[model samples]
Target chain A: MPALRKGRCLSPILLALMLVAGLIALPPGGRLTANEPQARLHNVDIREFAFMPAELTIRLGDAIVWTNRDFAPHTATSAEGDWDTSEIAYGQSSRQTPTQLGVFDYICVFHPTMKARLIVTR
Target chain B: MTPIKTTLLAGFAVFALTLPAFAQAGLDDLEVAHAAYTADVIDIEYAKLALSKTKNPEIKKFAELMIRDHTAVNEGAAALLKKLGVQAKDNDFSKALLKGFEAKKKELSALDGAAFDRAYAANELAYHQTVNKIVGETWIPTVKNGELKAFLSQALVTFKAHENHAGHMVTAAK
Candidate 1:
């Protein structure tokens, strides 16, 4: 009974702290709306001469950040030559928000063997 | 012996003497940096030569890539050395690399058009293979500095990718 009481007593306090932490972690100008999904940031790491996630799927409004974790420079360039995150150097990053919904193939212009796919959905 | 042949043999003898230094386990951080930078410069020079001689778009593009990537890697190496407040030390391995480069460059310079492209691509394949092996199996393991070791590890990945690309170029140039 005592342990049960302690659990009941801490639940609301812990919930309040988590809520506050979530609010603080929100992006600038982000609002918690009940009817709409929030845009998110996804990371794609370049390491060991390859992309961490060779394929990715994200929502239309979400952004993808390609971080070059390798010493050599890399780029996230669309195979169709439409979008390019030109030269993300070592320990650097670049972000791209997809403007259309479809599957897009990309490669590092420097190392064409580095290929990946991005699927943007509604 | 003919003068050019004699000179070539003497150059090879000198380069062979330096080969042990390259294979020895005593390479310091600065020596490794010097060798890595020298390799970059050699590749860049080869690429520049290729660019000047080749009209094939694929070969031209590969040459441009070599110039861009090698220059970028060299710049990164320079920045890291400056940040560490150290300079790359000149060593026998770097000297040997330059000596070999001089002869190879002269050989490549004598060719034009397809022959030049094929030779350039073949050299790139061989060069990247050698550099990648040294950086991965030799320098990265023996480097005493943490930052330098990490830098060499990252550079090895890039160079391995270059090796693969160069292999493709060799096939395409033929």
Candidate 2:
């Protein structure tokens, strides 16, 4: 009976070692699992005195990032006084995640001529 | 010629020659307005050159802002002049400013790439600073017309912002 119990324990240990070995033998590029949650992201490049895409459309719950590629500082200020990213410096980024669905117009207070629109859809 | 007649003729010639200089010396409200307008034009010109020559996105953006804002200011000045029944007069100071800008443009045109961007940014910073100082200290105080003074005062706000922006660019370039 003692020998039988020892055999049972050794069999489980061997099985566990085989499973770990199998995992190690798998290809480097192979994915172990899936079903991870990832947030949707959009990028707006502020370049050449204007936003590359002056208008951006996204779905609700999605996030948009503005990257300033200019030498000077800029701001994304809402026309209606709703939201504002005070100042985005050179090579820096600012993000906005809008919950509401509508068309929003924004401009740089420093350069009022620099305007852009963001549209969010449900 | 008689001595008295010769002296009178010399006096007349002196007065005739010096009149233009005297007119330019103390810029009246009209002349000051014209000079301000001309300064905007000069800034726009330099910005256009920068836009054409620079590949750096930051510098290009700055140049574009300069062009757009200065053009708007110029247009506003034009409309105001038209409404006020005033003609923008060319004066010695404005002429000298343009000449200096021409030299600066030549210097900038000779540079390329990063060198061009740094030089352009530095020049912009200096230009805005000088303009801000002139508008705030000299032009604003000396302007005689209420409307013109109000315009200059408003313009000074814009220029101060530009000066701050340019200062940032200069620092970033370094």
- Top-lDDT structure, candidate number: 1
Instruction: State residue B106's C-alpha deviation in candidate 2, in Å.
Output: 0.6
Predicted chain B of candidate 2, TM-score versus the true chain B: 0.85
Candidates' C-alpha lDDT: 0.80, 0.73
**What's the true lDDT of residue B7 in model 2?**
45
Q: On a 0 to 100 scale, what is the lDDT of residue A60 in model 1? A: 89
Q: Where in model 1 is the C-alpha error above 4 Å? A: A1-27, A30-32, B1-21
Q: For model 2 chain A, where is the 10-residue window of minimal lDDT? A: A1-10
Model 2, span B42-127: residue lDDT tens = 88998999989989888888888787667756766787899899898888878767766776787778888877787788778767
Q: What clash pairs does model 2 have?
A: A49-B61, A70-B58, A71-B58
**Please, what are the lDDT tens digits per residue for candidate 1 over residues A74-108?**
89999999999999987899999988999999999
Interface RMSD, in order shown: 1.8, 9.8
In model 2, which runs have C-alpha deviations exceeding 4 angstroms?
A1-122, B1-24
DockQ for each numbered candidate: 0.40, 0.02
Question: A-chain TM-score in candidate 1?
Answer: 0.76
